[model samples]
Target chain A: MRIVIAEDAAVIRDGLSLLLTTRGHQVAAAVGDATALCAAVAEYGPDVAVVDVRMPPTHTDEGLRAAIRLRRDHPGLGVLVFSQHIETRYAAQLLAEGSHGVGYLLKDRVSEVGDFLNTLVRIAAGETVLDPEVVTQIMGASRRTEALRTLTARERAVLAMMAEGRSNSAIATALSLSYGSVEKHVTQIFTKLGLPPSQSDHRRVLAVLRYLES
Target chain B: MSFRVLLAAPARKRAWYELGYALVSLPIAAVGLIYLLVMLLTAATAATFVGVPMLAAGVLGARALGAVDRGVARALLGVEVPVPPPFRPRPGLIGWLGSALGDGAGWRAAAYRLGKPPVAVLASGTAASLWGSGLVLLSCPIWWRIPALAHLPVNTWPRALLAGTAGAVLLLLAPWTVRAALLPDRLLVRALLGPTRASARIHELETTRAQAVDDSATALRRIERDLHDGTQARLVALAMSLSMLKDELAETGRDDRLDQARVLVDLAHRNAREALVELRDLVRGIHPAVLDEGLETALATLAATSSLPVDLQVDLPRRPSAAVETIAYFCTAELLANAARHGGARQAGIELRTRNRLLRLRVRDDGAGGAAMGLGTGLRGLADRVRVVDGTLKISSPPGGPTVVTVELPLHP
Candidate 1:
């Protein structure tokens, strides 16, 4: 798949291009500004575009604005915005534009290379993959139910892992818990969160989130 | 003429707005007020020598009226007219009557009162004609799409064109012409209100002194608040947590298993350190230890560590309140830091002196002068610190080399 990257920092851009290229994806274009990124995307016709929320010429929301403009101008284009700060307003706006073809994630998540790439691929494939941190921040900001407050530290940990799209087996390994125990914790989380039983990974996570948020 | 140049004064000098208001408009108004006052006093004497009853009536009328004029002037000019100066004579019918009759300012004030009717009519008429016409004329470009001259015997495109052209001409002349109309009112106001430049300076200094004293009091309160809120509050929470650990230990009767007690002890020690550190910070906020040793001692420590070589001089024997000393120390330290880090100044120098009842601290760096703190809060915060202490801090770091910062605090008793 072809990808265009717009990031002001030369080192970070080089690293990202190197990382993506090594992952069997083509870096169609790489640039340091929103305007150039938009032009490059139009020229290269990339399948997915990864943009830093802060790019040059007013190192503020220029890149996010370019993202929104791209989405408006080219509705078919897939976009994933990475921000140093958890500024969810842009993320919410992009998601609200269309649930598909868009994803917003913290810059740190990219360090978890394989998982981050999976998110990019999901978004490019027109699947919704909201950053769990962003979702939690938004839910907290909006002052939803006391589900977060009532959650045991361990349960919250388990939920965070699930939100990261970790498999139950992966979560068991990470948490140093038996697979049986992880399964039980997942069941308790769903029941405590008031989510109806579901086997589909995406639906189960969404249901648990909807319960916690509401 | 591009008005954009007038607008784009660079980001740093956006403070030109504040400077224009303070240095230009205020002093001009103050001088004008003094002028009117002198004229009124002269007019009062001429009235008094003419008739005794007339003198009493004129005095009574002037006192009541000068006050009214100040309010009117304050509203129109957007200058804070101070509360009217106190009426003379003590609280008694006889004294009040005599002071009311004898007050020369009242008589002069009355003359201005007398002049008000004609002045108001002129002011109202001119303001309306100028502003209304200016707005209408300046708006021509927006409405010129329906192009025509309207003030013709018949409405037509040619007439609309003529009208629009006239409007453009009128709008072009509006600024100078309006300034002219306002010039008299501005002049009249300046003559009646405030005081002489020297007296105004004295008054400004006096007010600054009052602010300094208030700042000193506020500093004390803030220290007290910090101690109570930060260090004290943390200790309170720690005490409660320690008691909880004690309760848990008592219930368990297992000293060996009391890791929580160890944690609480660690927390208590941590809290103590935190309190001590915060107290030191509070003291630093009051006066840095380097500065506490004295100004020269303080600057020496700063110079020793800074990238640039600093030449320090302290000629003042007595300190100007802890607040003033603190501000001077921090400001000089910051200036030195800035010089070293950003200015690439190889050398920086500071001079401190207390003379003519003012404490002056000047720091200069021989480096790139374009160390624009700009709207950066650190420098502005330093500036505000000076303001709070009833002192003035001037920074002149124009591009090229040699940046200078001067902070002057009054030594008013």
Candidate 2:
């Protein structure tokens, strides 16, 4: 994997560079602010770019805007927005252009190194990935609460994982269940929530997220 | 008494100013008295068509003269009186006539002008006679040596000696007489020339409200910067270090790297602890935990850790409201810090007392005493904070000694 990192904090930026490089991933460029992030991504054409939502010169949404612009300018390049906070409006804006090749996760998720790396790889593979915190927030505030309430606890868990853009195998591993039973829970969630059952991980994410948002 | 002490009135500039003010008032008063009499005569027939406009013109003229008198008092008497609000007459003739006729400040000025002539005459007469007689008699011995006055009977040695002694006595009394004569004019000018009480209060609140807003904004920005650059960054670093440690541990069969992983764990632990400490300080900056235990305890805690030795005394009949308590606490904190930093003080004192439903906090320091408001030393900011609650801040810091700052807040604000 080839990557570019943009974070204002020098410690986090260097740690990320070291973490990816030691894991056999190429860190093409590691910059500190949004403008340099743009220039680096354009120069390196890395497969995926990890960007912090708060960067220099106002430290308020420059990274989010830069990521949005980068996605527009380079359709094939993937973007994973990493931030200390989960602003629901930011998630909505990032997911507005169809949830492919995009990821949004909290800065704390980096402590779970394997999970963080898996999210990055999924993003690079043209898959949508969302932090569980973001998914939980969306579920809490979802307009389809009546439909959501019809599902059992296990089926709701499957739906939340699906909204987080997890494949059945990943959901099965996280829930300590067999892949076949995870598939059964996914089918039950679809029927209960009145969503069309989708087989592929990418389609499943889109359907679940769209249903929750609507 | 020494002759120099007796003649001190002539040597001092204040005596001359009083004499000058008294001399000028006579002519100014004569003109003013004539105009006032005519205005009074016109006011008697106010039922007529032209009576109201004439009265308005007369009142406006008196207001102009009042401005002149205020300037004279400020320049000669060193009296500071704030400028009054102007006549806010509406547009069109009838609107203008109504407002002008009803203008309170104009009527007050007219009354001042009407009552000035008698006091001016008395003041000028006393100043002239006292200073004149004193100087002439004091110089009798010297002018007696002149050939023109040598043959005069009063020029004899004993008579001259008597005149000189009387002159010395009169000279000693001149300053007091002049000050006494000018007192009425000063009172009349101050009472009539300055802004009305309500207007002055409103203007003061407007100014302090702006300063309070700016102070709060600056404080919020500082907090944001602290969290962003301190605690948040520290936590992120701690997490990154822990993640690195986890990765190192996950790699098996590496005995040499075990020590490195242990070192990483130690570093992460230190970062986590430091982050917690930074967060605690930030929380305290927002609102101290000790405040919940009541203001007295909070102040005691503050005084205990002050850079300079602080003597804390709190005497409250009852507790002030939370808002007043917060203002009082922050005011004491800032003042104590200032006493240590800019004041370069050896010791400080904080005294809190509540009387007549007002909370008063007095902070004093035995330091170089030139602390002042509007000097960008946080004193002005503290004053603004106090005034936001309709409170007051007073500073009595004479050069070369102790600086004392007093802040008073309403107990129910």
Candidate 3:
């Protein structure tokens, strides 16, 4: 995998580069701030860019905005926004157009090396990935919506995992259910929410997000 | 007591200003008396409904006159009086009349106008007589040959010299008379035209409160930056180094000292993770980043994270000043925390609305009650904090199962 890292903190930037390099992924470029992140991504066209939310100049959501622009300019390139905190508004905005090839995760997730690497790989494959915390917060915000009230506890759990951009099998494994049962729950959620079933995981995630956000 | 004061430059300038001020006051006083009479007549006939608008207009006119008086005092007497808050009439004619009639400042100004005539008479009367008589008597010797003063009383040289000496004495006493006469007018203007003592205190409190609020906000930002750049950065680096070390030890496949080194690294990594969590929480407590979005979003986020189920509602005509919003946000945050920690609440509700130029936040909870302002530092601190902006926090909780807290704040600080 080829990657570019955009972070203001020198320690984190250096550590990220070293970690990805040691894992045999190519580090094409690493820059600080949003403008340079855009320039590097445009130049290198890396498979994935790990960007921080707070960067130089006005260190408030600069990287998130830059990632939004990158998603517009280079649809194929993946952007995984890393921030110290999770804001649902920012998450909603990043997923405004679509959830495909985009990810928003907290910086603390980096310490969990295996999970973070999996998320990077999943994002590079044009899959939608969100931090579990982000999913939890979104669910909390939308818990009062009429559409969400019909789901059973187990079904709601399945919905949460799905919202985190998990595959059917991954949901089954995480929830300790068989593949057939996960499929059934997913169908039930889609039918109950009045969403047309789709073959693509990206569309399924986008539909679920649109429902929750609405 | 100093004789030099009679000849001092400042005293001489002040004496001239006092004389001019006294002279100008009489005409102002006459106009003020007319305004006063009109106001009183309109107020007396207020039951006929013809006086309402008249009374409002009269009050407004007096305020205008007061403003001019304030300017005069400032220019001549070097006394600065701050302008009070403007009269904001509500919608409709009745509302306008009510606000105008209820304006304490305007009424005080009218009273000042009505009261000025007597003060002006005394001041201008004494000053004019002293200066006029002194000049006339001093020039009597020169004008003695004139027919106006051609009497037998001043026909000899000694009498003429005696009249001239008396004139000199009178002239020497004129400045003192003028100074004494103007003192009461100065005092009256300071008391009437300036802000009332209570309003002045409020103004001072408002200024200091704004300063305190801004200072805390800046300090919180600094702390967050320091943690972000110093402790959190170093901890992340340490964790990364340990992870690398653990990987290296595993790769080396050495039996000797490998287990010990791995255990130490694992402990260090765990501590690093814990430190990061604590630091994140500290930063959030100092100032939530979500607050930048606005109070509604920030409160929603707070509700989402609360241990108790929270139902939040926010209705605002517009955003308040940043300092005001920040103070309100912290108050809500502390109250919610208190509800969970001390009250053992299962459900909580927060409602924010603006009415009558006031921002009101009501927080209710279904919990074991008996909450008092002095029971905990949280409530006490919040009360003090809100008081900075002339806001009030009221708590009503008996030894029961429900508690309600309401905070009222000015829309702008």
Candidate 4:
């Protein structure tokens, strides 16, 4: 697999390059900030681009903005965002674009090893992998809205993972149900929550998720 | 015939009008001061001996001299003295004394007291010669009747001159002398018991602002520290892993070794991503972007997962200072966390209002009912924050479930 890394910190960039190189996946470019990241992604044309949420000048949401723009500019380009905080705003935006290959999680997930690489693999395979903590904050926000409260506890849980912009398989695995069962639960949740009567899919869930987030 | 008739008229009617002014003003002023001192003592719990009697005196004397003071004020200063509120005691003796202490009748009474001595001495000494001459001049009309006494006293012109001199001296000195007489008494009353109300509202703002500054600084530092130590570390690890993966790939082409290297590379990627999340958390801690949308939107962001229901009552028409709003937001977040973490409360309430040109922000909870402030460092920091704005944070957690923390900040732009 070919990957392009976008992180301002040198240690992380170098370490990620070394790790990828050893894995036989070429890290064609390890760029310093998100601007450099986008340029690198454009030039190298990697299979997946991992960008940090905060980068160089005015270390605010520069990285998040860059990730959003990169995905917007180059459609179908797999992009994963790394954030130190519980920020689902940019992640939701990314998922809203169509939840393919979007990863949002805490940095601590890296030390967990299995979860971190699993999320990475999932992202590479074009699946949305969201951090549990990030999902918790999202669920916390959605639960407060009138639109979300109408769902029962069980249905609400299903909606929460869906709002994470998860795939049907991911939702099933998360809720410990079959893929078909998860799909059924999601439909019931959408109906109960009074979301759009039609257009129930990953994008719709992401749309509703983003709506409840703000 | 007319002159002789006027001279013969009854003296009683003339006498009543002559001394009317003098009898009124001085007496009333004296009574007011005495009443004021007594009331002060009573409020301090010393009025048992002083206040009761003064109240009695003020009631009787103030009424008696009321008309007189009016006549004097009108005659001397041309200022009318309406019949003031009657010397009514509070519903009870204690309340009455408190009211007296609170009102400003003390200095007026004292002025009438101390202001008389020097005034009398000067006026009397200066007018003694004039009065003596007055006796001589007044005798002129009777001089011829007295025969020897009238004829020997002086010529008509001299008598006329003497009368003029006497009256002139009295008239010139009277105005100044009377005004001087009340100076000491007025000063005494003003300083002793004049209204001494200090504004509680102003004092409260000062205390609250001071606390607010402290809390903002502490919060900012905590966030910076969290970022410096937390996410910075992960990014560094990511860099190191990238370095290792590059070197391992160059040395070995085996599938298993490459797979192990792949794992490390993935770890670095995840580490870097997590670092970004930490950085975002730090950003939110500093200023939640939702605040830019508005305070309501920001609050919506906060309610994501509060343990108990947060009843909000914020009805502000205008926005407060950025510092104040930020402090308020953090204060709410901290309080909710506190309630959830410590307060076994079932519900909480938040209210916003303005009073005395202050932004009033309050948060309360219905928990174990015994919520005291010493419970957490978070509140201490909050207290410090409100202080920074020269505002105040009062925590009422009396070992029960319902604990309330109220903050007040200056609303001035």
Candidate 5:
């Protein structure tokens, strides 16, 4: 996959590009600030653009706004918003356009190279990928806490992963469970929450996220 | 041209006020003069035991009348003279009399009372004569028909017209003459009734103190941004490098040395990330980066992260100066912390709004109260901080329950 990186910090920008290049992905363009990020994405048409939430010229959500604009202009492009802090409002806004081909993750995730790369690849494949932290915040602030309490601890964990846009097999691997067991938990969660059964992974994520966010 | 000038003189409200001031001050000065002269004569009779005390009482009386004089000037002449500091007498009868006699402000007021009568006499005399004669002459065409003026030379039509023309010029000159004649009296009132030298110095110091407070806020913001952009970024990058290095070592081999190298690399990565977290917190403590968005958003973030539930309401239709915003943010942060840590507050509410060019931030908590500025440095320091910008902090916390803190700040430094 080809990637464009936009980060004001030079060292982080170089480190990210090097990490991606070493992993056999193409580093198409890397620049600083929201404007340059837009230009690089336009010029290179990369599969995924890793954007820092804060950028120069008023380092306050410039990159998040730029990502929103890019999502509108180029619907097919994948955008992964990376930041040091997790702001639930920004996550809600980013997903408001549609969770397809979108991702929000903490910058610390970059230290876990395998997981970070997997997230980027998943986004490039037009899958919704939210940081676990974002999912936790949404769950904590969700209005249906009373209903959410009905699920068992393991079922809750599986539900959280599902809200993060994970496939059944991915959830099974991460939770050290068989594929059949993960599917069973998913079914139970749907029954307990009275959610309409979603057949596809993307639809399942949207349904679960909407339930929690609402 | 003369007719226009004549109409313009009475048309100006300021001219009318000044003319009134000139007329009114003469009677006030005459009374002050008579009283002063009696006091001086009584003070001159040192053969009696009442000489010195009588003079002290007279000076004190002048000071009292000076206050009334200032009010009169402000009302009519539009002169705003600051009231001088009140007299602080020493203990005992003798000491009080001695201090009153030596009081500089009182002596100056007495001198003004004596000197003002002469200046007032001249100014009022000039204003009254010019205005009175001008009005009489300008209406000569009508008044000249009276039988009492039939024998006068200027009672004829041609002479009356000439006199009326002269009257128009004098009417124009009246305002100017009154203003000029009153200049010395205005100076006398200002120099005597305004604040004394010590209070003036205090005022100067307060201005510089406010400037210093603003300068420090700007400097702290700069330092925090620099740390955020430079040191914190570099630390995160270093952590990333260490993380990558650990991965490289893990792939290299199953050798003991390689495993040890990987462990060291992991430790370094963890430590670097920890350092980054610490630096981020320190930078925020200096100046929250979220504040760059605005105080509303920044306070929202603060409320969301607080240990106790915080109901934050900010209605600032217009933003305040950056320095004032910074001060207000810190004040809110400290107050909330106090509510939780000291007051054992279950919940807190922050209300920020602007009214009458003032930024008012009120924080209330439903907790064990008894919060006092004397009890801790937090509230006192906040008071000092707000005072620098001519702001005020008020705390109303009873012993039983809810604690309310209100901070009022100017929109600008």
Candidate 6:
């Protein structure tokens, strides 16, 4: 995959670049801060941009804000926003305009290299991927909603996994269930939450996320 | 000494100015006295509805009189008295009336006004007599030649010369007498009409203390960011590199030295992760970014992350100043940590609200309650931090069961 890296920390930035290069992925551009990230994205037009939530020049959500802008200006470009801590409000905001080609994850998730790379690949392929921590926080907040209260524990788990942008097959593998059973749980969750049934996984994730956030 | 005294005598122009000020003050003082008398009468009859408004108006009038006197002193005597702080009336009519009636500056001004008339009379009388007698006696020789002085006692040249000499002495002393008389008046105006020296110093300290509080908050935030973007980031990178090396070593499929390399990499990774966690905690302790959202959200985050089940309740009508909010948030965080660590708390409750412009936080724990502030520097440090804004901290714990810690802070520094 062609990627652009925007991070203020030199060690993290260089390490990430080296890691991606060793894996045979093209790192088109690497820069620091939001302004340079935007310029690099425009100049390189990479397949995806990996952004840290906090960057130089007001290290509070500069990367998150730049990612949002990138999503708006270059709708086809994928953005994966990573942060040390998961802020539910930032998650809600990032997913506000539907979850296509967007990802929000904890930086700690990078420890699991294979899974993190898979998430990046999924996001670059125009899919939504949210960290499990984000899903848990949103679930904790949405447990009080009437729609969520009606779900069984099993169905709620399926819905949370769905909100994390897991496909039915992946959900089956995680839960040790058949694909058909995972499909049934997804359908039941959509029906219970009064969301329109959709065949697209990205749209399904968005619908589940919107319900949970509501 | 006498020659030096003559040379250092108060300037004639300044003496004239003082005389003018003393003469002009009498009528103003009389009017101020009448106004104060009416105010007092109205206050005495304040049970009647009409007198209440009258009394309020009287207090305002007294303050205005003080302002006029301050202006006069500044313009004539070159004595500058700083204006006192204005009355801060509350929202309702009753609050306004109460504050107005209780205004310290207004009462002081009234007292100054009442006392001014006597001082003015004395000063003006002495000035008039000194100038008049000095002028008459200095022309004694000329007056003795006139027919009016021919039958008077001062008809001889030697006597006339003696009178003239005495007159010269009196003229030299007139300026000094005028200055001496006006010195007490200047002190009175400064004491009554201006903010006292102690209160002025207090105001200055309050401003600087508020700045210090804000500067410390900014500095802590900077430190947290520096650690987040510097040390923590570097540690995470180190862990990732170790992970990559571990992967590379495993992929080579050489079993002889692979196990040793794997163990070393594992140790490095674990240490890096541990360091990252410690740095993360240190950053959070310095200043939580969630606090920028508000005290409620910050406290909620703290409660959510606690080891024990925390019942959190926040009922604030308005947010406090940034410095005050930071202090309150840290106070609660420290207290919660204390409860969980030392108190053996099974469950904790945090309650926050604002009352009478004070932000109040209460942290209670159902624990073995023998906590004393003197037991550790944590509580003492928090108390000192609270005192920066003139806030208070109170703790109550008996040996057996429950502990409750309360903190009260002003909405502003």
Highest lDDT, which number? 5
lDDT of 6 by residue, B1-413 (tens): 57876855645567778878877777777787788788888889988989888888788788888999999999989997877876666536888888888887888888897788777777777777777788789889888889865887888999999999888778888877877777778888988898778767777888898888888878887887777877778787888888788778778876757888888888887887777767766776778878866889888877765666789999987889888999988888888888878878788999998876678899999999988877873999999989989899999989875999999988876
Better of 1 and 5 by DockQ: 5
- Model 6 chain B scores worst on lDDT over the 10 consecutive residues at B7-16
Worst 10 residues of 1 chain B by lDDT: B14-23
How do the residues A45-151 of candidate 5 rate in per-residue lDDT, one tens digit apiece? 99999999989888889999999999999988999998877787788889889888999987777877778889999999999888898788777656576799999
RMSD of each: 27.6, 18.1, 5.7, 14.2, 12.3, 6.8
lDDT ranking from best candidate downward: 5, 6, 3, 2, 1, 4
List residue ranges in candidate 2 displaced over 4 A.
Answer: A199-203, B1-78, B82-182, B190-217, B254-413
Worst 10 residues of 5 chain B by lDDT: B300-309
Worst 10 residues of 4 chain B by lDDT: B10-19
State the lDDT of candidate 4 residue by residue for A84-158, as single tens digits. Answer: 555555565666667777777655455444345556776777666677776676666443456666777877777
Better of 1 and 6 by DockQ: 6
Query: What's the number of clashes in each of the models?
Result: 13, 0, 0, 78, 0, 0
True contacts kept of each: 0.00, 0.32, 0.25, 0.25, 0.40, 0.30
lDDT of 1 by residue, B200-288 (tens): 56667867877777677567646654553344334433433443344345556556547667666656645654554455456445544
Model 1 chain A lowest lDDT segment of ten: A137-146
lDDT of 5 by residue, B71-121 (tens): 999999989987776686654698889889987778888888888888899
Which regions of candidate 3 fall more than 4 Å away from where they truly are? A143-156, A168-199, B1-12, B40-67, B78-115, B147-165, B191-199, B254-256, B296-319, B327-388, B391-408
Docking class of 4: incorrect
Ranking by TM-score: 3, 6, 5, 2, 4, 1
TM-score of chain B of 3: 0.70
Q: What is the DockQ score of candidate 1, to 2 decimals?
A: 0.01
List the DockQ of the predictions in order.
0.01, 0.18, 0.36, 0.16, 0.24, 0.32
For residues B71-140, what per-residue lDDT tens digits would candidate 3 score against the true structure?
Answer: 8877776777778666767646778888888877788888889778988898899878877877776776
Give the Å error, residue B298, model 2.
32
